[model samples]
Target: MRTFVAGQEAVDETEFVELALGIDVDLFRGPLEKETAEERRARRDVAREVLRELRESAEAGDEVAGWDALYADALMRTVPFVRAARGQRAGTGVAA
Candidate 1:
C-alpha cells in the first residue's frame, strides 16, 4: 500500500499515513452483526448517500469534484480505497 502511495510526488506522506491510521474500520464493515434495527437505520444518513455519489463520480472519471467531496469530510476521507485516487485533486487538504 505504501509503495502505491509513494508513486505520488505531490503529497505529504505523513498525512496519508495519519488518515489511514485514523480511519474507523467500522466504516468499511457495513452493518455490524449485533446492531439493533434502529442503529442500522440510523447509519443510513445523508452523508453516506453523498459519499455514494462521490464514489460513483470517482469511478466515472469525474475526479476533481469527487475527490473534493470525499476528501472534504473526516467521515468519508479516511476510507482506504480513497487513497488509490487521493491525488486526483489537491482536494480540500483539510482534515475534518
Candidate 2:
C-alpha cells in the first residue's frame, strides 16, 4: 500500500519508469492501472445501479450475490488479450 516517489533511496529506475507511465512493473503484486476519466464515470454509473439492486435485494431479504467467480472467469477469458497487450507494451518479442 506504500508507494515510493522518484528520488527515494529505495526506488530504482524501473520503479520510477513504472510510476511515471502509470504501469505496474510487478504485474503479480501491484495494483492495476487507474481507470480513465470515461471509465471512472461509467464505473460510477454501474456502481450506482449495483448499489440500488443491492438495496432492493436487502429489503426483500434476499441473499446478496458475489460475482467473484464470474469476474474470475471473465478475466480468465481475457488472459490472451491481456498477455498480448502486456507484450506490446513491454516491446517483448513474445507472441500471444
lDDT of each: 0.48, 0.44
lDDT of 2 by residue, 14-50 (tens): 7775555433333322224544447745654554455
lDDT of 1 at 63: 73
For lDDT, the strongest prediction is: 1
List candidate 1 stretches off by more than 4 Å. 1-44, 73-96
Candidate with best TM-score: 2
lDDT of 2: 0.44
Residue 64 error for model 1, in Å?
1.3
